[model samples]
Target: MSIENVKNVAVIGAGSMGHQIAMLSALGGFETVLQDINEKALEKAIDMLEQRMNDWVNKGKLSEEQRRLAFQKLRTTTEIKEAAQDADLVIEAVVEKLDVKREVFKLLDQYAPSHTILASNSSSIVNSKIATVTNRPEKILNMHFFFPPLVMDCVEVVKSEETSDESVQIAMDFCKKIGRTGVLLEKEIYGFIANRLLFALSNEAVYLYENGYADFKDIDLIAKKALGHPMGPFELMDLSGIDVGYYANMELYKETQDPKDRPAKCVEEKVKAGELGRKTGKGWYDYRKEVISR
Candidate 1:
């Protein structure tokens, strides 16, 4: 399971994280495939990737030849079996549902090669549980990449009780090959590493906002400036999409079955009203015609 032996990588989701993963794999010189059930989403991922790669070249972060190579290595498709067949590594980044993941892993076990490293980008679901439905539990682990994997440098290599030393080493090596700093976690925790800490602060922020502790902007401002973080919890939540934070809050609460972990009503209410943050052009703050922060 050497990193050098991994020639192809298949990312089984076309959303933000999956698209980012595919781009990184291509940039790292692996044949990368992005597959999704939604054809439109797959197309969007490819187009956005092309634009981002061009941007990298313009910024002198990547050579034109390297950019062309990355584009050549990237592929998009809708067929799971086709994508899994020759992939040396298959990462599942689908919706964060245990049963849906179980179904996908079961199929992956049947279609993907025996030596393929099956990983989930799930931030919270237990890897051991997802692995239970697959044939090679040791080959299945959580390779949790941060949002926008192309930029952020940390990869969480989550190991379950069933994870083999070889499997863990392989994952860490792959992360390094892609120019990412890797952290090894002994057991599967609720939110892996980044998201767990993020959501902890996020939940508190929601509590503050709903209780009228401060104005929305103030809550966001202090978290960014005073706390010395890149973005405040609300701003981060907005950038990540409010619905994402809402679902994460709900999932965390269910995982712990604790009221303390429960999300505030204000968050759910916002999600219900379709104020889904950056993607939707309205979250903690509103957006204009441009999709980027000002």
Candidate 2:
């Protein structure tokens, strides 16, 4: 399959990452489609995207003409089969479950053109499993983008056992076209690349907090001031969520089967208790307004 140019980009899943990828593709001049099973989710995504584009226009980052052009090239649909048929590049970005991903890929594999480049925005699941369901595995590659793809500049391209070098290079070229710095991996490993390093640092931070250590705020301040890090571990985890952090670390442990990579017990307990960070109003810190005597 030749992927010399990806003109039509389809993102399956109207969730956060999927919608963001659609936004970037549309902004990058591709005919973009964002699909989701839930019509309400797709509606919300479109509304949110309009607000963001308006903000960009207000800030002078994008002209009204550019925003109008972007909206023209973008589309949203709930019909998975229809979206896949004409897409030159289909990026599946649903929940990170092997069976779920395979089911979506299997459907796209049957319907999409054989030459269409099949990509995934998966953060945890292995690429090899998703590729095996499709006949043209060489056309399947992992093109993982960071959250807010329009803003973040980093991308990772992974080639699995069945994936071809040409596929990896094509993904690299596409990422550059979308205004990102692309890194290619030789083969599929767990977490691809960025998540592994990020979760490892988070695991240690959780361990520190669990022990007789400083409170979450203090630890965060230390990292921010002393290390000059943009965000502290706890603050970052809160933004990312304890549930997300713990789940990714657990997946890492599953991949390596090593005890060290495992998520901290305290994190497991917190996630189990539904203290899932900022969304829950409590995780590492209490969010209710405290009447402090200043």
Q: Tell me the alpha-carbon RMSD of every candidate.
A: 1.6, 3.7
Tens-digit lDDT track for model 2 on 33-116? 999999999998999889889988999999999999999999989999989999999999887666788999999999898888
**Candidate 1 regions with alpha-carbon error over 4 angstroms:** 291-294
The alpha-carbon root-mean-square deviation between model 2 and the true structure, to one decimal in Å, is: 3.7
* lDDT accuracy of residue 149 in candidate 2: 71
lDDT of 1 by residue, 19-81 (tens): 999888898899998899999999888888888888888889889999988889988889999
TM-score of 2: 0.89
12, model 1: CA deviation in Å? 0.5
Question: By lDDT, who's the top model here?
Answer: 1
Highest TM-score scorer:
1
Cα TM-score per model: 0.95, 0.89
